[model samples]
Target: MTTLQGKTALVTGASAGIGLATARMLSHAGARVICCARALERLQIQLDEMPGPGLAVELDVADAVSAASLPDRLPQDWQAVDILVNNAGSDIGGRQPFHEGDINQWAGTIQTNVTGLMQVTAAMLPGMLAREQGHIVNIGSTQGLTPVAGCGAYTAS
Candidate 1:
């Protein structure tokens, strides 16, 4: 647990819940934080509700082009991130039978959870490896951990 003084960190899904908590904690610990999520409205609301200096990036991690643009989006001076929290994911439309489900719903979930994670991690990795220092925390679903009926499709993919 470092103080994070003068460090730059990016936390995905930071507009709510665990992501929000971690971002705030990191800020308190002295990290220069960049909080990213899909919902601009929610992110703005969170930003307005909170107190202090953190960058809020309107990002859709599931979008590969956007994830690939990370280097371009980073502040020139603060391009080197010391911490990356890959916490963006969504369990949309609840637990429904695989047959009855839209199937398209699962795409977004997997794209965010699996593909998006890889893209973001890959994008940020060079910087970390170059400096030989960094930490990445990924959030995974409990359903993906076990045999849940609806989760079958999501877990399998």
Candidate 2:
């Protein structure tokens, strides 16, 4: 392993599940990590359980105002971000046929999964480009690739 010992990485949706798994892998490679998620307590607990030191920030990607302000809110200790994993995503809340689905849930689904994903990525990518080195990983569901009748809504994610 070419040590990532001095590198800094950020893993979004790090409170649980796949984001947590990715963070663990990156940390094992010797990268310093900063975790973000809407659930602060869960993020805190996950960070505590991990084998290294990291910062946890509460973030809701659906909130444009908050997402826009992330660059300025980075910790003083964090300078350049070397690795970025855009793993924050959400499921749509309807299982009904596309016609019968709840309208608000449908809209919320796109807003969070698609629009919010873009917003967060836009805010971070510029910095990575400025540094000329970084990595981005987006988590996409299998349902998005192949249709599962009831999960079309979540697949819209």
Candidate 3:
């Protein structure tokens, strides 16, 4: 197994599910993990449970300003992230035909999954490039490829 001793990892949407699991794994691997999510309370709970050092930051990736400001907002010790997990996403507005779907729902999905991902990556990439070593992991669903009828908005994102 690859050991991440002394490395710092940032995981978005890390209050639950896969993001939370990944944070734990990274912590176990000896990386200091920074967990970001809108649910600050939950994130703090998870961070407290981590076997290694962890920090919890409240964030809403769907907001352009928030996503873009992530790097600058991190504590100095956690700013040079060696690993980034772009795992924040949403599936609102339930299943419905594309034409019948709510425009707002579609917009929300796009904002979170597409635009937010881009903003976060742009904010973090410069630092990684300058350092010449870093890893970015983008979590995506199989729905992106299958494109089920009622989930067009999600698939498109």
Candidate 4:
């Protein structure tokens, strides 16, 4: 990884798991990190303990209206994101036979895993384009590569 001394990284689903780890790693690498998730208080607690500067934001990527307004919602100083990690995803209803799966749950999974990622990226890309520099990391599951027995929605997303 290259030095990110002056960069700003925005990570989705940053309350825990891969998103949290990525935020910390970026902070350690010297970038200001914006950690976003549905639970602001929880995410803020983690951000407070990180090595470098970080901002905790409440964002439910599954909400289209919120996702569309994200760029404008950010503070002026933090708006110019240098890196974006689109890691907000869910395997709602978990593994089940396709015929036995709930359609609503499948929709939820697709909304979060696929549409949510696209919305956030679309929100942040303009700033990156204007600056002529940025990086995007879209976290994906191996289920996408190897067909799974009971994760049709997850694999498709």
Which is the better candidate, 2 or 4, if ranked by TM-score?
A: 4
- Against the true structure, whose lDDT is highest? 4
- Per-residue CA lDDT of candidate 4, range 33-89, in tens? 999999999997998889999998889999998898998899999999999999988
Residues 43-140 of candidate 1 have per-residue lDDT tens digits of 76676644456788888889999898986797787688889998887766568887888768878777887888899999999989999999898876
lDDT of 3: 0.91
List ranges where model 2 is wrong by over 4 Å.
none
Per-model TM-score on C-alpha atoms: 0.87, 0.91, 0.95, 0.96
What lDDT would each prediction earn against the true structure? Answer: 0.81, 0.80, 0.91, 0.93
| Residue pairs in candidate 1 whose N, alpha carbon or C atoms collide under 3 angstroms | none
After aligning candidate 4 to the native by TM-score, how far in Å is the CA of 59 from where it should be? 0.7
RMSD to truth, every model: 2.1, 1.6, 1.1, 1.0
**What is residue 62's positional error in candidate 4, in angstroms?**
1.1
CA deviation > 4 Å runs, candidate 3: none
lDDT of 2: 0.80
Q: Is candidate 2 or candidate 3 better by lDDT?
A: 3
User: Could you tell me the lDDT of residue 45 within candidate 1?
Assistant: 69
Error of 2 at 92 (Å): 3.1
Ranking by lDDT: 4, 3, 1, 2
